[model samples]
Target chain A: MIEAHSISFRYHEAWVLQEVSFRVEKGEFVGVIGPNGSGKTTLLKLLYGLLAPQRGEILFELVPMKKMDRRDIAKRIAVVAQETQLLFPFSVLETVLMGRSPYLGRLLFESEKDLEIARKAMEWTKILPFSERPVEELSGGERKRVFIARALAQEPEVILLDEPTANLDIEHQIDFLDLILTLNRERGLTIVMASHDMNIASEFCDRLILLQEGRIYQMGTPEEVVTKENIESVYGCEVWIDQHPVSGMPRISLLRKGGR
Target chain B: MKIITLKKVLTISILLGFVLIVIILISITMGSVKVPPLRSIRILFRAILGLKGAGNETERTIILSLRLPRAILAGFVGAGLSVSGATFQALLRNPLADPYILGVSSGAAVGAIIAILLGLGVSSFGLPLVSFLGALLSIVVVFYCGRQEGRIHPHTLLLAGVIVGSFLSALIMFFISLSQKEELRTIIFWLMGDFSFSNARSILIIFPYILLGVFLLYLRARHLNLILSGEESAVQLGVDVERLKLVSYLSASLITAASVSVCGLIGFVGLIIPHSVRLIFGPDHRLLIPASALIGASFLVACDTFARTLLAPVELPVGVVTAAFGGPFFIYLLRTRKAIRTL
Candidate 1:
């Protein structure tokens, strides 16, 4: 489990995240939902220790993240950020093997055991067939899977994802969420995902944290947070909310002003 | 994605090592005076093994004293520059990065030109020392200028390097314009990269710097591979990204300084050899670094050979030969190879 206490982060004079505090419990899928520039991505980065909070602290299993070595932090928490530009044409296998880097020494190459773990991760992500292909040649969805496999290869207790399905088609988006859901259920991997899609988050996430302008607007079950009143107040938009017929979760639909 | 095992790396190294040795032998045999390959190899082994024999004195002298040292110096310089190039490319995550991209070569050139103008003997260590100090100074200034919020930003570093390099190059041009006829020729020859003046002592001086730099880089090869993914990801993967950048930058600059001090600016070996190696081998720095060193050594030795022998009595600068040969060949590879297009 991870805990944040009054953590704030600023990029110059503007605070990207202000007085934000939350907890991610073990084996839970927590979706962080917000509009553009709501500090979702910044919060995920702060959670993984990529950027330190300007005030307060983050703790992993009751230990302050500041006290943990980067390698130690990496071993417990993995992140699949938005697709990074691939500078080198590293093969799929090579890219996946990089996840084992936290466990490796400066001079050490991946051992047979590390390779085995990576292989299993690739298999779990259903990307084993293209293991020899360079990552640059993969489609966006396939590359996302490759990154998930890479994060899985870390064998972390928690995985942080930043708008992972933003570029995918609906089919691939559902497929990606399903993969993550399976990991949370089967492997007991705690997930803290940042997403813009409200319906998808409602159906998949155990709980939702709604952020508005660098502060948590609401944090509760999807039914409690994804109401029509909350959406209009925070997003300043007209919206209709209803239950998803299949899963019976809260569903949101945008409404034009004076139209619907 | 075949696993890069120790055995595979060693096998490739040995194969390239053989190629390097064969190229060195061929280079030694070639010159205005042609020594046969067999006799050159014999003279080389005898000299290396410290064995005395009734060999032809002129042939022995040419192979042992002049051509041999020049070829070895070329090999070291080639290896150093290419390895530095590969390291810089990885650190910056830009395929266009080469060893001289950081302004180290220009700084060294300015130092060497100043030493030449001051009448410092080429044979003395003072010239090389001053050149290395200049290179070191440029590195410090560039790094200082490139820092953002206590971290070195790649774009800022690159921009700083260009600015510093341009400033130093202007200084070099100013010095060149002010020099007299004899000093001008020496300055021009040095700028064009001459290996004719190389002796055993010069080779000895640069050998350790190049070796240490390359060895330190090789040790960081795995970390470099992780870095190619991106700095943020590298940090998440537990790499000390800042430390890696600092170490690689300094090591690559150290070798570049050592090489430019002894042989002046050799140009394309650093830029082309790493690309060629990456095209043949994969982008994995573990193999890329050593393979580039070997191929670069052979390429430079061969280029230096052509510089000395192509016109017979009239010698061309090794830089001219490298650029002329390397440019066309790299273009050919770029045109024909699909993999190279990705870079």
Candidate 2:
């Protein structure tokens, strides 16, 4: 389990996250949803050890994250940054192989075993044929999959994805989420994903953490946390919440001015 | 894969052979005391191979001492600059960055000029001493000021280098304006760049420093490769990122300063040779660094031949020849490379 205790952070003079706390367990898919500038990314960054908390500490298993070495932390947690802007033309295989960096020896070439692992990861993500192609030449959805392969190659226990579905098409987004769901249920991987799509989060995530202006408004299962009043009050939008008859999960739809 | 590697080796070897032949042919036949290529080789064989009664003394001395040392110096300087340039380009992740952009060249120029003006307290190797000092000081300044938090911000370093380089450049101009007319001519010639000044002693003293730099850079090949992913990635990859960046900046500056101290700035080999090689050879520094050295060496030999013989007896500074040819070629390569990369 990964736990954050009453985390607070102040950037320069302004506070960003204040008294936030949550837990992510093994095999659980927790979705964090918030508006822009609502500190969703900030919280994810803290979880990834990219930023330090001002008031509290985080624990991985039983060890405090601060006490763990970065490389050690990296061995267990993989992060897919929000913007995957690759400035140089690294080949797809080369980019994914970089995930194995923390495990290789200095001045040593990637061994056959390591290459095999990278190949397996690419195959898993279906980016194998593009191994020799420059990542700069790949399309948006392909690049995202390639990045996911890179993260998977790390073979980390916890995967923190910062808006993995952002900028993707509707079909691609669903496909990506389905892949994540498979990973969680089949492999027992702990997933912490942030998304702006409420319906997708409701259908996909095992639990939801609602953040509003840097504070946690609510944290519970989708049915318990996402409600008509909470959506209308927090998001300032009228929403109709009802059970999905098939999945038995809460589903919400924005009520337009005249109809829902 | 094996075939490609073999092909790359064969290609590089052929290019190297071409460079060596060009350097030999042009060095012997194009100097002030010129000789025919046949007699030049004969003379060079007599002196270098120590074959008695093979050639006359004048031809032998001209080939062995004067033109030959000068040619070898050009080759070494060309190769050294390009290698360092390649290293810096890899480190900074910016195609435009070179040892000069770190204020090393300006610093060396300022030092050489000051030594010329103040006389450096000793006549022996005064110019080099001053230039080395200048280069060293600028590197320290750039490394310290160029760094922030834990990483060297490429833009900030570039900006600092520009600021410092301009100040030093202005000072060099100021000194150039103040010196006697005769001294001024020598300074201008030095700045213009010529390989005709090196001797046995100067070469030996400077040789070890440049070779040491090349060795260190070669050793850090993998570390340099890791840096392209950004420092955070480099660190995650088990590299001591800060240390490697510091090493790269210092080592490249060392070779740049040493070469500029002996020969004036020969511009394009550093910027273009590595870039072109990378296009054909890929961005793997292990391959690019060594390949660039050979390509650069041969390139300078050809360029120097042109500098000496294009106008004959009245030698043009190698720098002028390089810029003249390199400027347009660089523009063409850069524009095309950018256009191709976007696709």
Candidate 3:
């Protein structure tokens, strides 16, 4: 559970986030969607306490974010960033084991239980076989899965991801979403993700937060907020919105705007 | 540090062991005086088993007086440089990172150069003391310039390191130009790296700082591993990324400064040794860091031995010997291992 109140952020003269506020309920899967430079990442950073708001405060489970140590915050939340460029060539297992660092004591090595947790996390993420291979050698999809395993290793109640599916292939994308959806339902983890793929967010998210120029433009069920008129108004585009035949979720298609 | 099942414990141990033996033998056999190979071996065996021996008083003199301390100094220098290089590479997460890349070497160089200019070498250990002071000042200066919002931005730190290092090097060169020609020769040899005067005093002088640095780094081995995942992820993993960074820069620079003050400039042991260890063993800092220390000490001991004996009576500077081998060997590695997968 987390909340942001009237957060405003500016970089130099440019405003990145303006008076943004939102609450993520426990066990909620909230998908944040917007075009590039819509302040999605800035909001995420603010929520994670990586940045302090220029205007307002972020509360993590009712505590002022600034009051908690970064390590203490890590025990409750895990983040999987878009890219992991480690110049030190670590093996996949080594990467996953790092997830246990938050819970480890100073000077204490990873214990049997810690290693077991890492192993289980790797198994669930299906990267157990590549345990000893360097992370840099991983395919994009495999590396993504490895990072997901690392987050899972944290055993956090809330997992925040910045574009878990951006570079994935369609097949891997389906696989990734299914895995995340499984984690949400079975583990009851809170999932907050920012994605550019509106269709995936519409299909997978329980609720969607649509952002436009650093402010919350719309927030509702996919069917309630993904109307063609709402989308065109926010995204400046025309689209065909229809139901997915199998999942019965709203699936959108772009119909070129102001056709020549 | 979790010892992964795939951890090659035996291989690392074997490599360390093999290097130790070679280094010991090399150090004893070669020095300013060319004792017969057999006599050197005899002296080595006696020293190891604590056996008493006779007439080799001069040989005994060479063993205790000249070779042993120099060998120890060489090992310490190697270990320090290698570990420093490994730490820098991890902190920067750049393959090109080395101990000197942060300007610690140039800072120390400038410090030592100023000592020479001020004629501080007249004191038995004044040069090392002044050089250490110089190094500390450079780190303080670099620290001030590198800080932003209570943290060092990696890019800004790297760039500032280069700028500061070059500036200090320029100052060192300026002083070298103004020095009397006789002092210049001595300064030049010292800059090229030598262990000719290494003794218990020099070792004892810098030991606390070097060991302190090594200790500080050792405690954060796991944190450094996480840092390579990028600072943001490192923070998410519970490392005090900002605080730890300052510690990293300060501790690393302290060791670099101290070691350089006492031993002068050694080349490439830092870059080549760490990368080589990484290539053989994966980049787990737990393994890589200790491995860097052990292997680095042995590597430098061997090189220092080679430098002393390669031309006999007139010894080559250890820096020249190390650089000669390290530079060409590095290029060879690049050519042969160019396509070696990093992922």
Best by TM-score: 1
lDDT of 2 by residue, B275-303 (tens): 87776666766667778888888778778
Give the winner by DockQ: 1
Per-residue CA lDDT of candidate 1, range A28-139, in tens? 9999999999999999988988889989899999999988888998898999989776887788999999999899866457889999999999999999999988899999
Report the lDDT tens digits of candidate 3 across residue range A108-165: 3677798899999999999998887878888888998899899998889998889989
Model 2 chain B lDDT-worst window of ten: B1-10
Q: Report residue A25 deviation for candidate 2 (angstroms).
A: 2.4
Fnat across every predicted model, in order: 0.59, 0.11, 0.66
Per-residue lDDT of A75-146 in model 2, one digit per residue for the tens?
788877666646556778877877776676454356667788889988988989878888888888888888
Clash count, one per candidate: 0, 0, 2
**Docking quality category of candidate 3 according to DockQ thresholds:** medium
Give the runs in model 1 whose Cα sits over 4 Å from its true position.
Answer: B339-343
Question: Candidate 3 chain A: worst 10 consecutive residues by lDDT?
Answer: A105-114
Model 1's CAPRI class is medium
Question: TM-scores across all candidates?
Answer: 0.97, 0.86, 0.93
The DockQ ranking, best first, is 1, 3, 2
For residue B278, model 3's alpha carbon misses the true position, in angstroms, by: 0.4
